[model samples]
Target: MPDNRERDRKDHYLPRGFLKGFIDPANKDLAKPLWHFDLETTAWSRESPGSIGWERGMYDYHPGTNVLEHPDEVFERFEREFPLVREYLLRRNFKGWVKQHKHFLLEFAQMMRARSPLFLQQQTAQNENTRIMTVTSVGPGNQVGVDTTVPYPPPARFIRNRTITAMREEIKKGPDWMENFHWCLRYTRSVADPFVTGTQPIVVEGRYPNSNDAPVLEDALNDHNTIIWFPLCWQACLVGAVDRFDEGTAEAPPSLISHVRGMFRRPSAGYVISPIKIESF
Candidate 1:
């Protein structure tokens, strides 16, 4: 029988770099085992009626509880309520609409940012043993892509399109946009697969501690204390462990494909070391 000391040694025998960089010195007991999740950008599907028309106005009226007013009726109501405002909206195009609804638009964006982390916390509470670290993109791929056959709902559709485009542009210019932008992008996609195992997170390669995308990696490390970063292409998987504030580093673990190949080669193999829990992302 394996002794307690032997068991301890086997369990704690992670790569040296992984331990020094990721594991919190204060919590050397490995209180929460680190898990990684990947993010992917997907085009919007137009086939489903529920998926279409995600404008602010869509939530204002329910098909069951209220009659869906025609666009002209809605516009007439808006004009009646604020006659002077109608002229401004007509003259400035989308700029006037943005000015009028700036607060609501910002709030919508903020809500999108908050949803994922809250969901993740809820999931974690349900199962404390599994730590889910989500990875998403904040670069160019954050723009909306659609694959729909139905015609958009006129003015509402235009408003939604303009609002999203403006929001994306604003996010691109902001300093800490990546953190919030990624979540917002995911909310827009509204796909079932949370982990996005098939898609790879964007990797910005350069200098060790001072790369352009370093903050993004650092932020993830700080949040979860460890990350399993699977880059796209044929790049090796990176196991990042966080040691302290902005003091995390990564090590290349054996590729999953290679590990599987070795397993197939030796079916009678008693044991195989893996960098992460192989069951899920």
Candidate 2:
């Protein structure tokens, strides 16, 4: 008989299996039609010539070359004028003293790029049958289910899902797939504020397969399945957990949660993380 333990060890690192959970039929609501949302921003800058303005139409910020003169007013205007951008900035604590710092605006732009459909759509377009969906909102404070004094704003919450077929094709390109996926995740982390973590607005209902229960790479490839789900903000936690596991340090990392037997589970259904680190760099 095949040793299920050995199979799990090998399948744990297979990206295909991980991707399948996102597009499973059971997750259709979370995988709502990609065309429902309109991401177009207003060109708020065009009307205000020679003044630092926000292009509400195109969702671009015009610095007017001297944005430092009135940092507070500039940011305040952003908050009052551009609701979406304001929500994202507030989550990162971009106000008062923080507004004076260099790289504030640049960081805002980077955050928008990471949260926007621009990059995902570009990547998905490369594949013939792939599509991308991005949902953005400012979360309600009470809605997060975590006790905190701070109010969660809309536009700060972003969920991105891309057709898994694109990811599979990239995986077929040999080891490059690993690099590409890791790079994408890291880039996202770098651009986002540390406080900005993913939220599970849509609950996926299904049985999450354990690492040992994952399908083999060959089977996963032939299955032609896809997965779509929110990207959780457990990268740091994951790294910490894996590090402790690898070094055999004292107990499991505190970040490790929802453990069932050999696999570590996420709050979202059908997503599992193996104890060992699956990708590097």
TM-scores for candidates 1 onward, in order:
0.20, 0.16
lDDT value, residue 52 of candidate 1 = 16
lDDT score for candidate 2 against the true structure: 0.24
lDDT of 2 by residue, 1-281 (tens): 21122111221111222122122233334423111111132111111111111112122112222222222222243224333443343355433312342233223222222222333344434332333333333476743333344434322112112222232333234322111111111112221111111111111112333311232133322232321122222221111110112231112232222221112223322222222122210
| Model 2 worst lDDT window (10 residues) | 42-51
Q: In candidate 2, which residue ranges exceed 4 Å CA deviation?
A: 1-122, 125-166, 174-251, 255-281
lDDT tens readout by residue for model 1, 26-142: 333444422222212212211111211122332122222222332223223322433243234335532434336433333322222222222223323334333233234345768
Candidate 1 structure, TM-score to reference? 0.20
Relative to the true structure, how large is the alpha-carbon lDDT of every model?
0.27, 0.24
Q: Judging by lDDT against the true structure, name the best candidate.
A: 1
